[model samples]
Target: MSMINYKYSFTILLAGFFLISCNGKKTENTRENNAENQITISEGQFKENGMELGKPVVKPFTEEVSCKGYITAPVNARAKVTSLISGKITSLQIRPGQFVSKGNVICAITSTEFIDIQKDYAENSAKFVKIKADYDRLKSLREENIGAEKDFISIKSDYNAASASLNAARAKLNSIGLNPANIENGKIYNVYTVTAPISGYVTSISAVLGQYADMTTEIAEIVNVNQTQLTLSVFENDVYRLKPGQIVRFNVAGSTENLLAKLISIGKSINTESKTIDCIANMETSLNKPLINEGYVQANIITAQTELQALPNSAFVKSEGAFFVYILKEKKSGNYIFEKKEVHITKSNDEYSAVSESLPEQETLIKGGSTL
Candidate 1:
């Protein structure tokens, strides 16, 4: 009876051990099924989560170089108004920011030298008339064989000398802004008018109403906004990529609007102090108002174009100094799994980025992977 009890107890223990082993196997299988690193979702769940898939595409990529610069008027567009003759500023007609047209009188000056020039012109004119009349009379006598050859020659020489003096005096009056015909009409005035050389806004005024102005003094400055240029300083490394007619996009400092410009010229040599070359560009569009000369600006020059394999910027996920994306894999009907992938990005813009590690073009990519 004891031996029978021992056999029954041994059987019970064996059965219990087998059951426990089966249970452990089931638990291990369950954990293996759920331990995948990939994420699996049904079609309905994907739509609910607002997930999307796309394929990599080939698109045109533009390479750009960044630069800093300022707005400046071209040399021909800027004028330094100066007096051609020394005089006292009797009347000042221009102030800073005033618009003036070409040939408009900017100031009036009075000087004793101006009066003396006019008087000399008038006296020379009278002397020339008398000498010419005497010359003509002597020539008539010589032709009729009634006057000596020596006398006629002497009179002709005097006439030529008088004519030269009169011409020189007239030119001097003209140089002082006096019309020679008006001066010859006996309109002698002490004040000489100084006119604007170009149509533009006056930027500076240095002549006072009662101050004396010399020929070398800068009376005022005029700048034509229409001829303004964008002067950019490009580093030596990127200067070789720039060329005339390239498109440029720039923004003024302290403004949000982007402006357009076209490259016009590039400097021949790099500056020794700044180690940069000058790039000149013209504005393609008119501003609402004239830009102040020497206003600071930031610019990007579109240098070259090529085709590249690009993806939307939303596809990138960055972590721990590495970038990643999600690629989709079909598991079964109505279900999909996404596997994380490592990629190297070459370049990026606001909307798209060019990546180096290329996948099959047919492979599906999960959009908005960074949010996962």
Candidate 2:
């Protein structure tokens, strides 16, 4: 009842465990096969023809191109005035940043030598007048047969010599920035009134009171600031694209708004260092007050303008070597659909340009497609 009965019970328990493990293994294998058979494949199709495809959308574009640059004044329009004769500056009536007109006196010189020259001229002129009067009277008497011909001849010779001396003295005064005729004709006697050479603003002044000024020395620089021209240096390639009379918009380097201007001239030579050509632009409005300094300016010059179908530059997509935009077309299911179309960029400005393709009818192009 003890050993044999215990052995029988242990065998029965071992058999029960083996049967349970076999059943668990069979159920796991069946479940694995069922999972593999559950997999399904569906055919991929394009939006237009039910084939695999990925394309961008396109729509119509109409925009204008605007170029911009800065303001500038021409250098040739400025003038540097110098003295015409060597003399000490006794007085200066004009200062820097002053406006002057033609014939306005800016400075004066006082010289004893000039005084002596004037004295000699006056004496010589008086002698010539008296000598001519005597000669005329003697000649008249001789012609009437009442005076000696020798006397008339001597008087005539004296008159000619006096006339030559007066003429020589007058030329000397004229060369020293004085009008000899004015002195002789009593319009002016001794003092010299130096006049301005041109109408402009005095941008600089070197002539000081009680200083010496010579003919070769510059006394002041007068600039016609009102008639200024902006000179911009653009690359040689950009220079070739610009033409005279092209409208340009430009602003100060740090400004958000731009000013209007026109292309006046383009340089024919290239700058060796910058590899750029000099461009001249005349401001449409007088830049009485410029935002930037002279000598250099940052600018964008307009080279050309044309009409073309174009959207915002961001709407274009680039893949491989082609560019495209996404256009939303209406579908028969009463839902919006997007299609991709290729485009060729002919020209572009900051905001718009010319394109090589037209947009589809009744379709709206997707903007900012590049972000997609």
Candidate 3:
């Protein structure tokens, strides 16, 4: 009877151990499943994390690439007035906002360097005359067989060298805004005259009258407002949606009406500070409103329009250059399960993005969360 009691107790202990092991395995499996594709958050925590639920909606969406920038002149439209020779400004009659025509005299620089250039050209001209006389006489003698070949060859070389020196001096004087012919004719130029290279308004003058200027100094800037373009600052996230020749609609401050433009170029590099790509657009026609240089502009690069599954910009989260969203799979006893699912953004603007994936049946996405 004691042995039977012992066997029965042993069997009971073994069965109890097996049942406990099974229960532990089940708990482990549950945790593994939950961790694989789920997040559990209590209602209090959910609200604290600023979680919001949303359902994906199908709608007729007009996709656009939204951006903002300023109206400014392109590089080709801006004329940077600089001096080839350093000198003190003897005369700067121009003022800011004054209009200037191409080749109009803007300033005169009293450069002693101008005098030196003139002197060099004069000396080169005199030397060239003497060398040419010798070369001509030597050539005549060579043809007549009246001189040694070596002597004529030497004179010819000297003549060629002198000619090159004279031409160089002439070019140098010309570059310094002096005419070699005038200098040779005994015209003494003490001041180097500077002129406007392009027709535009004098936006600024960096020099005061009598201030010394150099090659490095920007004497003035002229801008032709007619050549102004829409300089759009497209964010990096939306840069991929843009291309050259795309149409852009722009609006200025205090105006609801849009100005039309066509995109002409997209930037190759991104702005590190603003994380934006610089884009340029030209107007389809003359703008009705006055073009303000460096004026602020809000723009939309019109891409396409179609019915799409859409979500707010906040609904998408980016990771490793890919986009993702969270969906509420189940709710039980105040615990919520949010399954992270990858998503594709076909097109986006400031507030909304069209997603390629539609929501699963009956599943609502975590449209936004502070934890994200």
Candidate 4:
């Protein structure tokens, strides 16, 4: 009784295990199939959910070349405030992040050279006056045949030389922001004022109080925010595909919002260090926001436009490394039957994508609802 009963019980237990394993495999396969199968949504719910459908329309999409660079001001829009003369910085009227206008005094410096310039101008002015008087008298006498011709010529030469020296000294004073008219025989301009050359916000300050500065010393750097451009570096491989008037979309570092610009020029030479060509783009619009100078940005230069069959960005969803678009298969009773069809994306942009395979002519495609 023991051996026969035990054999029967073991066979029944083995049959039950096999039955449970087959059902579990079937359920798992069904779940996987459901993801790519037909989806049915009620018409009322679809409308409430703001789903839209239309035929695959032919729209323009651009093939883009990815790039990276910085936002920079144009050449004329940027200015370097420098010390035109050598002096120790006595005062600083402006600092970094300060806005200044053209001709505004940026700083005051005390320079012994300014005193020397003034002294030379004063001495030259006095000499010019005396020389001119002598030359005039000699010329008058020569016209009346009362002075020697050699004497008249010698005085004329002296007069011309004196005048030139005076003018040069005056120009030197003017270049250093001292008016010749404001100087007298002994009056000296101890403090020279440096003025801003352009209107812009100061980006950097290199000179501080008590610091010595010269013609090579840059006191500050200014950039006009209203006049800015994008300086992008595109690899030489993609350089030939670029041209003026192409659209450029960029995202500044630390931002995901898209900004737009237009390509204005391409650098003729490639960078030896990077093997990339410099591309200049003018900011077409900023939506009331101004671009910061030297802001790093990642950009896509839209190169070519082609009209192709495509759908809205929301209409396609990526799953398991493939893109699928929802197609309206049929409307039965009150249900909208949509099928998820894998699509071959030939080209794509931020707003649309072009599919290689043409969908059915009469069937409509969902343009908005992909998440459902």
**Maximum-TM-score candidate:** 4
* Cα error of candidate 1 at position 180, Å: 1.9
Error of 2 at 225 (Å): 2.2
Put down candidate 4 lDDT per residue, 248-286, tens digits, no spaces. 999888888888999999999999999999999998765
lDDT of 3: 0.83
- Candidate 2 CA-lDDT value: 0.65
Candidate 1's C-alpha runs over 4 A off are: 1-59, 242-246, 260-265, 268-270, 284-288, 309-343, 359-372
Against the true structure, candidate 1 reaches a TM-score of 0.74
Ranked by lDDT from best down, the candidates are: 4, 1, 3, 2
TM-score winner, 1 or 2: 1
Query: What does the lDDT come to for candidate 1?
Result: 0.86
Task: State the lDDT of candidate 2 residue by residue for 28-63, as single tens digits.
Answer: 999887554332212221223232222323333323
lDDT of 4: 0.86
Q: Pick the candidate with the highest lDDT.
A: 4
lDDT on C-alpha atoms for all candidate structures = 0.86, 0.65, 0.83, 0.86
Q: What is candidate 3's lDDT per residue for 147-226, written digit by digit as tens?
A: 89999989999999999999999989877666677888988877788899899888888888878888888989999888
Candidate 3 C-alpha error for residue 313, in Å: 27
Give per-model TM-scores: 0.74, 0.57, 0.62, 0.79
lDDT at position 189, candidate 2: 39
